[model samples]
Each structure stands twice: as structure tokens, then as C-alpha cells.
Target chain A: MTSEKKIRVLAAKPGLDGHDRGVKVICRALRDAGMEVIYTGLRQTPQQIVKTAVEEDVDVIALSILSGAHNELLPKVAGLLKEQQAEQISLLAGGIIPDSDIPYLKKKGIKEVFGPGTSMNTVIDYIKNYCAR
Target chain B: MDCLCRKISEEKERWVKTTLNKAKCDRRTDENGEDIKVLYTPDDICAIDYLSAIGFPGEYPYTRGVHASMYRGQPWTIRQYSGFATPEETNQRYKYLLKQGQTGLSVAFDLPTQIGYDSDDPMSEGEVGKVGVSVDSLEDMEIIFRDIPLDRMSTSMTINAPAAVLLAMYIAIAKKQGIPSTKLRGTIQNDILKEYTVRGTYIFPPRPSIRLITDIFAFCKDHVPQWNTINVAGYHMREAGCTAVQEIAFSFSNAIAYIEAGIKAGLAVDSFAPRISWIFNTGSRIFEEVAKYRAARRVWAELLKNRFGAKDQRSWMLRYHTQTSGVSLAAQQPENNIVRVAYQALAAVLSGPQSLAACSYDEALALPTEKSVRMSLRTQQIIAHETGVTDTVDPLAGSYYVEYLTNEMAVKINKEIAKIDEMGGAVDAIEKGYIQKEIEERAYIIQKEIDEKKRIVVGVNEYLVDEKVDQALFRVDKKVARQQAAKLKKLKKNRDGQKVQLALEAIRRAAEGNDNMMPLLIEAVNAYATLGEICNTMKCVFGEYRASGWSGR
Candidate 1:
């Protein structure tokens, strides 16, 4: 634990959905997990989120969308990150996304897709495990 | 006082120790963990004044019910609020709902529209018509209300930040339908205060948002006399995981802020107060919710009459719409939600709401399909027609436990409201982040409770399930973006561009001054101005709101 660097996570809401419940809860958990968290508030575009993740040099980039715009918005953000040469940052997605769409989001570079009932422990462990990987 | 009451109270201790010990059932507390006594007798509510505190229905204080007849004269309006995909699709849904015996129209606009964006805007790219109907301009509004006569129907638009723009669009549609503003009967969720405090759909900062809301109040008092100016909301706060007590207190405090703002803006109390209605969430907490509605009515009635000097009885009545709790619906064994919704609806009906929108069973998975939505509506119908629950007025009014809980909730809520008032009111409290923090703390507690399996949420917690979600879910059309964009482009190209520009200029000019912006808003939409155009004009004057000191964020 002493040898591990503090994980910097960029938590962002990448759509017009104002539902900050899930994102805020996750951010609090990440911070409590001894991670440095930078929260970009609601209505951030794909490019803006990716740029923030890059500029902050975050180890993990977490995105939440409840407005059913994940398929269109998630891929755009992931693609922009790769284009911006910030693909090293692990991308994760969460919120009211359907199970069927999880395969597409995963294929598009979202390392993890957390749904409604996913425990905070799972999220923190995922970040640690992903970092280890 | 009575022999049976005394015996019950005396025997309850022995009953708890002997019978209940074998039962091993825990004592029931509220969502906030407040004590709930096993049996409430007259001694429990001895402090309450029946006539003064718990007055008769339709009378002062309105603790029992708002109208004397309650549902006997007229049952609560069955309002199933929904929309998604596109305007045409939404219109088809609206027509279907109306044909299936729904009494009212409640519109749910998409995220982009709710936040005041056109379908073609870059901010609206992927969210064209996902959460609700997308109305880029008057064209969409026209399609939404086509062949549905405005004068004959009552509509409720679930919008907040851009409520003024949407209301104007509705007015324009009514005008085209040959209905005058005075004849239009409905409400606009023109509650920007709740948006700033709880929900985050706001476009302008609090000050200007209040100004816009007050403008609507003044404007509607004169023009749209039949319209409810604002549906002051506690539902969203409750959905955000506030306790029933906090929900009532915080919402009342917000309502107080609006009333004060309206009066300070030079409108008399009676003129606008009658149009003030509320929306509350009826959750799984059956007695607590009924008591919440009851307590809210009494508190509001007294506040209007005493605090604000509202002379009219209509102003004192706390008429509210109810929605069965969305948070209570679980994704696990989604079919279980129907039973949850039925009880919630029953609680709402027992407590008396002006209307209700029961959540569909499949809502926890995705947007409701036609079959699920119909079942939701039928849930309300069964309660209204077959359940025999609506046959009595204030059915639970005189019950010892109900009265005791109502009094308890009212006192607690009023105490909290007093603290907020001492802090200079809701807006100041929100800016200070007190309200948001309170809600966040409660939300965190509830979430943890669920996670730790302390609260048994049926299929979610205690009752485990190994099942697949095989329900055919309603998926939004991906092509809606392109289709709406093309339509918006064609409409912008074809409509009288000069008239639109001129109308937008009028709104910009109105935004610069203290003048009421409602008329200009209506004219702009009527002249084919897009929602974004109107909101942008105001944004130039009242720059878009950026939340600050958000410790949670």
C-alpha cells in the first residue's frame, strides 16, 4: 500500500442528464478509497471530459450518463481520448445503461460498466485491480 | 379517556413483552428512524386541538381534506406522465392515453428540451429525445397537441428551468387551436427554486430564475387566469431520498420563498396564491406518506393565512399532485413494482391528491413499454373504480394512529421550516449549501441502509432472486437525432425568419428590463422561435447559472 501511488480519478457527467446521485456517491467512495478525484460537473461534452482527464493526468476516467445517451456519448468520449493520445487513462461508465448495450460500451473502450445496484466496494476494487493490471 | 382506550394502553406493555417477544418483530419507525408507537390512543394526540388544528374538510387549516366531498364529487385525475423518442411519437402516446380514459395530460420533455436546447444544438447531440419528448419549437408543440383541443384538456408540463419558454409554447398552441389563454386549464412545473435547490435542470442563476417565476405569476394572474402558475415540488426532493418530514419542510420552505418573492415583486397574495399547487411523492411508507400529505396541508393552510395574510380560502387549500415513489421501484424482480405501486397509489388516494402518476413496473429497467404503462394506469383505475377506497372522505382522518402521526409530522416539519426561515429563507439556505447537504446526507444514509440490507426492499434485499430481465423493454429510437435535426433545419429555413428574429429581439429587450417576459416569450414561440433562441436571448442578459461551492461535486 505504501509503494502504490495515489490513484487520480477524473469523474465526469458527459450528458444533459442532471442526475448526479450515482456520480456523487461514486466520487465520495473514490475519495474515501484514498484516490484524488476531480469532478467535472454536469453537461460536459466528450472532448471536454477527455481533455480534463488528460490535463489532470488521471489514472482512471469515470463517466456517468442517465439520460439514455450512453451509446452515442460514451464512444465519442472514448474515441476522443484515444485521438488525444490519452488512452492510458482507464475509462469507466455507469448509470441506467441496459445490459444489452454493455457489450458495445465495453468494445468501445469503457473498461467497466457499473449499473444501478453496483456496490461502491466493487467500484473501488475495480479501479485498484484495473490499475494493477 | 375511555375504558377500552385505557385498557389497550395499559395492556400494550404486557402485549409487547409476552406476545411481541414471541413474535420477535421489531418496532416500526419511520424512514427517518423516528419512533412509531405500537398503538396510539387519545392520550397520544392529547395535545392536538381538533377544531383549530385538525379542522373539517374544506375549512381552515384543511388537515383532514381540501374539499368537503373529497373523491365523492370527483375522483382524483388519473395523470400518467410520459414521453420519449420524438414529438410525433409522444403525440401518439398522448392520444393513446387520452383514448384509454386518462383525464389529464402531463408532458415529460427530454433532457435537452428541459434544459432549453434545440434538437440540432451541439449540447443536445445524443440526448435529442431520450428521457422525454423533444420540442425544438412551436412545430413540435403543434404536433403534440394536434386534434387535442386545448380548451377541452388540462395539461401539466414537467419542466422547470425553461418553464417559461415551454408554457409560452403551450399558449401559442392553444391560440392556434382557437382557445384563449383564459380558457386554458393546466399547470407548468414552473418551479425554478426546486431546480436550484434539488434538481439541476436550471439554466439561469437563482435571482433571475425567481424573477422569471414571479413574472409568470404576475402574467398568469392577468392572462392565463385558469392556469396553475407553479406546481411547487417536493416529489423531486423525496425522489432524491429525503425523508417525508424533510420533504414537507423543505418544499414548504421553498414555497414560502416563492410566495415572498411574488409579493415582493408587487403581486398580491390572494391573486397568485390560489394558483399555487404542489407535487409530493407517495412512497412505500404508507402511514407516513398519508400523514405527510395531511401535515403538509395543515401547515400550508396556516402559513398562508397567518404568515402571508392570504385572505382567500382557495389560497389556503393545499392542493397537490402525487406520484408513487420512483426510488422505491427496484430493478430486481421488476414485476414486484406493481404491488409496490398499488400500495403507494392507495396511500396517495387515502391521503387525497389532486392527481396521481403511478410508476410502471418496468420503469426500473427502462422507459415503460405500452403494456407496462397501461398496467400502471390501470393500477390507478382499479383503485379509483373497484377498490371502494374512494367511497369515503378522509377515511383515515379520525384514526388515533393517523391523527397522532399527522400531528407529530406537522410539528417536526414546522420546526425545521422555522429554522430555515431563521436562516433567511430557502434561496439563502440553498446558496449556503445547507439544503443540498441535508438531502445528500439523507440520500447517503438511505443508500447505505439498502446496501447493508438493513432495509428489506423485497426482491432487492431480503427476497433474493436468480432471474433474467426478459421483459421487452422500450428502447428509444437512435434515428430520432437525425430526424429531429433535419426537421428543425427545415423549419428554421421555411418559417418567417425575419419575424422569428424580431420576436427574439423583443424577448432580449424584455430580458434587459424588469418587465414581465411571459408575453414576449409567448409571442416569440408563436412567431416560430426555437426554445434555444428564446432562452439564449435571456442568457445574454441573465448568463447561464454555474453552480458554486458544490462540496459534493
Candidate 2:
């Protein structure tokens, strides 16, 4: 079960969306997949999300937003990470995000945007591959 | 064990063997994955006493239903949960819904309002009017209900945390509409317990939150007798992935805490219990969903009667609203959700809900569009008019399978409630993350089942297709944020700042003292104080609640 290191991931719900089923599911899946996952509970600002990701020294930041606030919140988190010199941590998110917004979110520095019907295994595998190098 | 029971079991054995020996990989299970016998006979419900358990409708322990005539007298209210973007757009949507034969109105406030922030706050950037309608001040509330008369419409606002402020705004608007507070009819979804457990739109601590709920109860009982002060909701939690049994058990547990808070606040049970409403999510699992409603009503009736010693018949009737599950909607084909929502709405009707809200097909992808919302409302109409489901009272009552499932669900849910009772109460269980962990575990199991192709999600796991879905989705313009911000600024500039300050200070003093804050909140809204200002003033007194996870990182 041992590897070079376990993938430390920070999962958080930013802004005022209270629907955390997706985020909690991802947090548990990543934790069960042998990643050190820290779930920052709901109503988090972008600053708090990135602060925990950096402080916990996580490799990935999984931002879950069902409130459709990702476009506004995602870039804020990414910008904060860049300003705080924590830009190396990959930003990925999944929720009720539309396919039309995926490209824009990706261009905004999100590594991936998982929408509805996404598999947890796919998410875990993506993180594993992204961190393997 | 008994000879008669053994004979009935032998008969069922013969029936299963002769009629139903087919494929066997979990084949005998319901949609919820619960094992079901091919036949349920008298022996299945041997322990039940019909006189006490399944009494007549409108009777004590109302497992059959809260009303005697049920849908025969009048069909369940076809209330659509509609709201998105600016208040003006939402008002238009409401008018359209009412014109399309919607009987009741349900308002869905956006994230900023739900969590008690004005649309202009820096914390509200990019989020205003995204999830629900952005309601910033009394002016927004006025516009939301503008040509719509307050006296006739029984509105339901799904806004918690800052429920007092919103309720205040509603009361003030009714006043402006020349309607007395006593004549105003509606509901404020002030159930904050589920927010701490599942939905995360909570502000202030649980203690103060409960206090505000009690304050609403006390105020509404004498002032706005028609208003439902708090709706004990399991709708969000079930959408968050709790099992049917947990939905009933946990929401009732939260109900117990609220009832206790009301009594502690010196309000009588009969005074508020009649107006108390329960909201359940109608899932795709037909039998389980029906049984969940039956079981939920039974549990609530018994909880009110036995635990709280409520004497009035109205206190024992568990009136509830049902909403089709949003989590059950598929994002793939998207059209499949119409069928799913129809079936769920059918279950809600069969379960005898006081009201039902059908989720539009495109809800999973975005806010429901005009066509989709109309389609959903027509879906309810079809059930009411074309389908004969509303012709009788609890049509599925006599079915052996339904009765057996209902009893089993009641027992399982009772066990969970007992466990929560042992662990102090719902509030304590939530603070301990007990319910959250249970829901998360169930959510994980369902997600894993979908991923493994065990549980079939038609358009997702099965019926695979690569065809692009070009269905129109309702999208909120980014300018909605700017517009709401600008409106809030103009309102602040136009209003008497000194009066707003005095009203907010009154709210703060009431929050600091043990006074019920509803009167002060109503005064604040009358003074044109924004939701954020009122909530921030209370926050200055009670402080905001910050939840750190069990990981302790």
C-alpha cells in the first residue's frame, strides 16, 4: 500500500452552496483511495479554501460548487493560490457545472471540471496520474 | 413461530416457488435495494393493531393521512418551487406559474439571501441569483409578490438561517399590500437543523438558531396565525443522499428538538403544531417513497402525541409537502428525468401529500427553463386530472406489499430514532457528525452503486449515448450580481439610515437578551434594513458559527 507519498487532497465547498453530497462523497472516496483528504465544510471563502490547501500541503484542491458560483469562486481560489505562492496545487472541481463552462473554467487554470454522471474512480485515477509525475 | 403464521409462510413459499423462480442476483429487491417477498399476507402485519396504528384519516397517529377526504375533497396543492436570478424575473415566473394553474407558490431565495448576505457583499460575488432568487431587501420581497395578492396565495419561501429577516420582509410586504398580518398566509422554511447536518447554508450557532425558530413560532401563533413558522425538512437531507428511513427518523428527531424548544420558549403545542409542516423528498423508488411518507406521518403523529403530550387533534396530524428529488434527475439524456419526476410525483400523490413540487427535467444541469417548469407543472396536472390517483384516499392502503413495507420501514426508522435519542438528540447527533456521516456513507454507497453499474441510472450508467443534448437551460446573467448590488446600494441610500440603525440595534439588544427577536426583526424590515444588516447585527451579538471537520486539520 505504500508509495513515494500519499496524495494529499483538500476538498472544500466555497461560497454559500449547502449541497455537499458531492463534496462529501469525493472526500470519502479520496480518503479511502489512500489519500490524506481534508474537507473544509460549507460556506468557505476562496481565501479559506486555499489557506487550508497550502497549510495542509495538499497536492490537489477539489472545489465543489452546486450553487453555480464556480466561475466566480474558482478563479478567486486560483488567484489566491497564485498570490500565496501555492499555485502548484492542482485545482479540480465537480458539481452541477454545465459542459459549456468547462472550457472556460479550464482556461481559468482549473485542471479539470467534473460534472454530473462523473465517476469517483475517474476522479481518483485522474488525481493519481496527475500526481504520479 | 405460530402454526397459522407457519402455514401462511408455507403458502408464500409455494407461491414463490411456483410463480417466481427466475434470475437471482439481487433480483427480489425493490429499487432502494431492500429485499421484498413475492407476496405479503396477513401474517406479515400480525403484530399490528389497525385501530391504533393505521387509524382512520384525520385520526390520532395519522398513518393513513392527515385529512379524511384526502384528494377527493381537493387535490394536493401543485406548488412549484420557482425562483432564480433577480426578483423581477422571479416575480414574472411566479405570475406565469399561477396563470398556468399553479395552486400554491414556493419561493427559492438565492445563496446570498439564504446565508444572510446582501447581494453586494464581497462574499456574495459571482454567487448572487445563481442558485435561487437574490432577495436583498423589503423592496425585493415587494417585487417578488407584486401583482400577486398576499391574502389569496399560500406562499412558501425556502430560506433558512436568515429566515426571520425574510419572514419579516414578507410580513412587511403584506402590510404594504394592505393586507393585515393576520390574513397573510405562507410558510418560512426556518428549519436550521438540517443546515448544520446536510445543507451548509447555516449561520449563527444552533442554540441561537433554535431560539429564532421558537421566536417565529411564538410570534406567528398570535400575529400571523396562517403562517407556517418552520417547516421541519428532510427534503434537502434526502437529496444529500440519506436513506428513506433516515429521512423520516432524522427529520422527526429534528422535529422533536424544535418542539422541545417551542415548549421551552413557553409556547403551547396546539398553538404551533397545526401550522407546522414537514417536507419530504419523493424519490424514484416508488414503494419505498410511498412507505416513507406513511412512515413519516406515523412517526410525526406519534411523536407529537406521545412525546409532547399534545391534546389537540390538529397536533397529531402530520401535514407535509413533497418535492420530486433533484438528485434523482439525470444530466445525460436529460429527457429521462421527466419520466422519473412523473413517477416521483405519482408517489407523492399516492402518499397523500398536502402539496407537491415536480422537479423539471433539466434541473440537474441548470435552473429549470420556462418550458421545463411548465412541463413539470403539467405533469402534476396530468396526475390530478387525467390520472385517477386523486379519486380516493390512500389508494395503496389495502395493498399487502405496501402495508408490509410500511411496517418494516416504520420499525427500521424507529430504531434509528431510538439510537439518536440515546445519543442525546438530533442537535447533539448533528454536532457529533453522526447523521452527517450516516448520510455521507449512504451517499457513497449509492454513488458507488451507480459507478459499478449495480444501480441503474438510465441515461447515465445504461442507455449510453454520445448525442449532444441541445435542450435550453435557464442561465443567470452575470449582470444579475451587479444589478442586485446596485439595487441594494440605491435602497440603502434612499432609506432612512438612522431608523435602520435603530432597528438593527433593537435586534442586537434582543439577540443579546433573551427576548424574542421577531418583533424587532419586523420593525427592522419596515425600516428598510437589508437582510445582511439585520443578520450582521445579530452576528455581532451571537457571533457566527464555524464548523471544523472531524479531521481536525
Q: What is every candidate's C-alpha DockQ against the true complex, given to 2 decimals?
A: 0.51, 0.67
Q: List the residue pairs that clash in candidate 1.
A: none
lDDT string for model 2 (B195-311, tens) is: 888887888999998999999999899999989888889898888888888888899899889988898889898989888887889888788788878877787787778888888
TM-score of 2: 0.96
In model 1 chain B, the worst 10-residue window by lDDT is: B544-553
lDDT measured at residue B367 in model 1 versus the true structure, 0 to 100: 89
lDDT of 1 at A23: 80
User: Cα deviation in Å at residue B99, candidate 2?
Assistant: 0.7
